[model samples]
Target: MAWPTGASPYGIGVRDAVVRGVGPRSTDGVIRVWYPAHVPSSLAARRYFDGPDELQIMTRGLGWLLSARGVRALGGWRTRGHTNAPPAAGRLPVVFFSHGFTGFVGQNTHLCERLAAAGYLVISIAYPEAAASICAPDGSSNVMSAAQRRRLVGDQFARAMVRLLRARSIDAENRAISEVTAVDTLARENDRWSVHLTAMLDALVPIDQRRARVDTATAAILDAGDWSRVALMGMSFGGSTSANVAHLDERARAAINLDGMQQGDILLGQDIRVPLLVMSSAGSMLPSGRVVNDLHYESRRTATGRVQRVLVADAGHYAFSDLVAFGARRTRGLLDLGTVDPERMLTLVADTVTAFLGDALEPGGDSGTDETEVSP
Candidate 1:
């Protein structure tokens, strides 16, 4: 992808590959990793899992689709470029990126690429049964039924089953679960789903056995003395996942949640010790904005001391993801989305997130800036 104009003082690097040993979830999906590449260094970054063959084929297919749509919508298809490694004397900070519900890691490549360019090693995980894996080369092995393939997985399936049964009791129960469910349940589900999601992450572990094994990979990477800091970020449900991860993962120094609803104990129970930043939609902050208000209130109450919340003037939740301008443009209207210029929205998110991480993780980095001011 094209680096935003202006060279990064630390320079930038890019690498992409399918993490193996991960998917094929009933449908087999592979996780993709984009990290700061360090070549000719004494220590080589290991490659984790070799995803199942079917999964690799599936990834290629999805990649093609995304590339086509992205080019048509974004004006150009940006290719990944190469850069020099970080000074061997120090290690780079690490950032884990989680995608929205039913979204793959590649969906937010634009944002993740920007973070990578800004001198951080970024790993984006693709959740199984939650992402669109490519179909096999012969156009075979794509097995998800039409219903299962829909973006809104469980809810759609539940509604269809309820309608087919014509069972009022079932319908009522589903509605109650939807209405009365606690946000903590959502957070717990995020953790639970991660159990399966870890497979995709396995691909990032270098193939070498000496450094560490798959089980201890994440810990090993986080504990590296060379790593100056660590941060977690996500959008929508992924944003909520980041909150849960930050609350539990002591290694996480900070977190950024992009328009995700707060659920479970994250809001009602646990205290967030690390610095937290919440970016929401301006429309969602208006009189009828329960999601934004509830999250803002809960975050304020739970944050120990450091917390920041801002509503992008004309942006919507999807603004943080590529869906607004990359996918079917019609999808934008489906959310009753507000009109934030796409380029401005992307820059606002990138700059705000960079500033947040800089202040919280970088030693002596500037942190006092408030809302990032972008012209309409």
Candidate 2:
């Protein structure tokens, strides 16, 4: 689906590149970057999880038992800037992006690209730890958890996701979801990803800290001298991590959770001094989803700065993903990307994200940049 770039004074250009030093997975895990690229070469967008015989993998993998194809790139690859492209005139806000469980760094490119266009340097990290698998640039892929696959596999599971996502009866949906037990799964993964916030910040910011193995070559590409303008954002499981991590990490200026359910430490209680934006699918914001998210939002609202919650009407758990637009509309794949007007949802999600980030990071910027600015 085509997402819009708002009429900001800054013209938007994009380039996707990779960085390592986070973990030991040369292809196991890598950080993906979507920065402002004024002039980029037209390189064909390549697939990290789609092909079996390619040379290397630049991202994470999400799929069912049969297919491992990550969301296929539908020709926005021109954003891949040449190595060491110039940063926009000034130091832009640095946004740390974490994708949902079993999702690639590019899983939420629609949002990342939009944020980049709005003058933010968005970086996403994908690892095989919480994902089904990660692939090498040589096209050789490996599975991280056969157990995760078993838990998510089968016609029964797909129907469960579809029912929980598309069910008319909220009670039935809640029961089905409870039976599945993915919330615990999500929370654990969120914790795994969240703990890395300090490490991620250590690498991105110019501060001297004992860091993960710094990917010196890739680190050179980053120009983030301003540690004050940092934010954490993620979708689904990633969203949960953003919320929990924002509470745990002192450096996060703000955090946004896009339709991710709260569990684990967030439920036990966490501190929050950072502004948080929690967005949910209108449909799934009920029963357990609402119960957890509302409590988290309200608690954080009291503990810290602003905690804004908005619902994307006519959307589902997967609405924040590109799967709905690029992948098949139906629940044909491993993920039940429910049917929504992909274009409309993308527009709504992107607009809300841009506004929220602007309000939180920009000095003298009003919080009116939120969903209130975007007509329902």
Candidate 3:
């Protein structure tokens, strides 16, 4: 399989493995895996979205959140993907991924596939109910509604949380969530993410070599992954989940947040135990935009563990996504996707993410992230 030019540094292959997450919220969803493929691509390339409807929903939903004028209509849309191919030889570094609020697992395919091309096994989980829509392997769809969302978080204030996401100022958003709901939301999502991390680990055991938990397709790629050496990463709400999981589980070698807002107890004086990299978008540096990033940086400002906060130039919240290049940007300047070139931004993000994970997961790569600095 082949990846886009700027998406990765190497050629990669992808496969879809269905794993039934065992625990409180046992979900049956697709875990998209991207790996370094030595085998040639004999089959057709994979579809980027589960279906055209999913693509439309993602494009429009993100537009509504990031674009004041809302997402422009989709005309001709295309995606870059190579899926369900044979696994590459040799076990590779494993990295787990999470999506943003009201976003699906496949929302950040470019980032996940880019890591795969860089010789890392990348897994992006399609969140059930939490996402606006989740596509299962059996050709069905699951969409989360506002009423359902509040239940997922075990709260009655789902509308308030949604309103907060649309708030123009950080102060407004901060004020939207009271101390009680803040803790409740964080604790619930943290438990959900923790369960996901543990379930992924459990799925790593070989089917014939162990008990029956994951499907055969998942078992095929499990042997080639190093469970001992794993990393947790996410975009948007997934970032909070990744941070929370990395904090609780020592197995997470590194944690990277791609323009994700911090969540849960971390806002209430919780320290991240593992190494963390906060890659903020250009807009995040703005006075009004700094609301979420400010809290994240403050949480680790006085900590002792390795934490590097780098601000990317000419980027916005959606820059971490493929929408910048793929979506129809009808109302330009209305959305703060990024001021810099989309490809350039993604290349930098992909490179920096790989470097941080490499240093943390590998021996003697570069454990020093002492100073909080901005990238050029």
Candidate 4:
């Protein structure tokens, strides 16, 4: 379970730092920012939630699983020949990442690291309630109740529907039932957590206020002139979050959804001005036909008319995240959770994501390419 290694490129440097206080959560939220270390550029750091202890516990849970599978941090990937940091004056493009429900921000370390190696500033945010963050002297703690745990699992199913709805247009009867079922299921699952997720959304005195706070704070840190472009990405629940954020946030120039289910107003088809990229696991049990239709609908209706869909052959729902291999090995009964070959699966995800991000965020930059088969 060694951490996956990234391929380094010439003239590009990489470094990472954890930024605190970007969200409203009580805990000090972190934004792991990665960028080319050779330039003298300043970039705004992206932020996410700061509250919800359950999310932190979930992150730890995933980490424990990874560690059990032998995935230790191998340190940062700095170019051996290039010791000087990149100019800090020039801003690099920015990309924000959200993890799957009950997932830690670093679950997709392979993909984030590869994007960093390609000369971009990538920020992966941990949604407090949605992520699995662990805290304990020995790292053996379950912060969520049995019900909360179930909601976390159910959130995945809800997101699957969101992706499905977005790709295809539903017929009159199907649309009504799909929307009602999706909303009803989500509400039922949220109730299990005492409707914590719903409460957060409802508590926003003025819905726009929440958006304003996040926007103001993020804009201040991320206003680097060189980082002129921005993108959003997520997995599972994170993917749904990305779609929601992209729909509402004008700052995002594009978005990528990696096998996440969508919920709430996000599924109703809001206007998306930027490009949208949808990636899915070819072997997932979720309905691909529905997802394809939603994607087609969004692309055709959106102002940009730019939407791309890709399927990773033989990949499972967890293949896009670091959880696939790590979870399988660590959790005794989780073998059937994802594809068996973890390293290869990670490589495929990393390569595809890097290429897609490069093309979307840094149009002029060299978009590196890699070809690898998806393994189950």
Candidate 1 per-residue lDDT, tens place, 128-205, comes to 545554332233334233354453435644554344334245444334334423334343456665554344334333
**Best-performing candidate as measured by TM-score:** 3
User: What are the runs in model 4 whose C-alpha is more than 4 Å off?
Assistant: 1-6, 10-28, 38-60, 63-89, 134-145, 152-173, 180-225, 265-271, 283-304, 327-337, 362-376
Give the TM-score (vs. native) of candidate 1.
0.66
Worst 10 residues of 1 by lDDT: 43-52
Q: All candidates' lDDT scores?
A: 0.53, 0.59, 0.64, 0.50
lDDT of 2 by residue, 55-170 (tens): 12322233342243432343223332233455556577889888776666666766776777677877777655665455544444565555664543566556656666665665
Off by over 4 Å in 2: 1-3, 6-21, 40-60, 63-85, 133-142, 150-188, 207-217, 267-271, 287-291, 300-305, 327-335, 364-376
lDDT score of residue 7 within candidate 2: 55
Estimated TM-score for each candidate: 0.66, 0.73, 0.77, 0.63
Model 4 Cα lDDT, one tens digit per residue, 182-251 = 5655645333322332232222213343345333433333433243476778887677667666666666
Decoy 2 TM-score against native:
0.73
Model 2, C-alpha of 318: deviation from truth (Å):
1.0
TM-score of 4: 0.63
